[model samples]
Target chain A: EAGVTQSPRYAVLQEGQAVSFWCDPISGHDTLYWYQQPRDQGPQLLVYFRDEAVIDNSQLPSDRFSAVRPKGTNSTLKIQSAKQGDTATYLCASSSDSYNNQAPLFGEGTRLSVL
Target chain B: GDSVTQTEGLVTLTEGLPVMLNCTYQTIYSNPFLFWYVQHLNESPRLLLKSFTDNKRTEHQGFHATLHKSSSSFHLQKSSAQLSDSALYYCALMRGSALGRLHFGAGTQLIVIP
Candidate 1:
């Protein structure tokens, strides 16, 4: 079984630029999540979805950050007009259980640097 | 809301010494799942140990953690530290009702020296 896969392992962007990160969850996984992890800090939940419906996105920055899992198996996280403060690693995780009763498996993450 | 706290920012210990990382959590739900994740350099975070039962010990890869609902604590421990154990550890909590969302601590970086 393959693990969660994320694209563009790394990215470098300037202020006011737009960037998008992609994620593919594990097979048969019903729950997917996106997290932002800054240097020396823990992973913070940005948003999550169960199948095609969003479960929670309260932590997401609506003005600049947006995420969607249209078909429920893949997801895309986009940042509009990025700022220096947006520099961080974006992690994608998935759980096999629909209710997320199991521990999540994480991807290598996309390291983004905004200058 | 659920939250986790790791009191230690960094812990340095020599090989063969005991290791202990403190973790505490706050949550309104009585049944909360606690998890410990380890991330090595340039790697993704993986689950080290997890437990939802109170007063029960969960062990994985020579590391152990016991969830104590009475005190709202779940501390990671190991008898002897190894150089390979150097990494960042995060303690996380998930409310019983809100299963998929995880609230993580700031993290503790453990450096095991020879």
Candidate 2:
């Protein structure tokens, strides 16, 4: 089975520009998550969903960040007017169920740079 | 607010020695789950172990962590270190709910020198 897959393994955009990263989770996984990992820090959950319904997005910057999992299988995380602070590796992960935080499979992640 | 802490930002140990990584957590939720994740350079973080039962040791890939609810700690430990064990380890905590989102610590970088 294929693990999570992400596009544009590397992305570089100028400040104030916009960029969107896509994620394809593992087959049959019902939970998907988007995380922002700044350098030297752990991956922080920005948003997560179960079967296309967002469970929580409080950590996401309302003004500049948005994530969607329309089909519950693939997700997109978009950054509007990207700032230097938005520069980090965006990771997408998925779990088999919604009950446990057991082990989540991750993609290679999209390394974004705002210059 | 819920949070996780890793005291050691970096640890260097000679190969064949035991490895210990300290992890502590604080959460208001009564039922909390703890986890340990390993991230290699330029790769995404992967789960190393998780805590569901109190005082129950969870082991994976030669790494183990015991969740002590009394102390609210889930520290990762390995019997012996290997060069391959060098990586960044993150401690995480989550509530068993609809959210199920994990709150992670800053992470500890382990370096096993030959």
Best by DockQ: 2
Q: Candidate 2 versus the native: TM-score?
A: 0.93
iRMS per model in Å: 1.8, 1.9
RMSD of 1: 1.5
Tens digits of per-residue lDDT, candidate 1, A2-115, equal: 999999899999899999999999999888999998887788889999898999999999999999999989999999999999999999999866443467889999999999
Candidate 1 on B18-104: residue-level lDDT in tens?
A: 999999999889988899999998888998998889998999999999999999999999999999999999998887645548888
User: Superposing all C-alpha atoms, what RMSD in Å does each candidate have to the true structure?
Assistant: 1.5, 1.7
Each model's TM-score? 0.95, 0.93
Off by over 4 Å in 2: A98-101
Best by TM-score: 1
For the second chain, the TM-scores of the candidates in order are 0.97, 0.97
Residue B93, candidate 1: alpha-carbon lDDT: 88
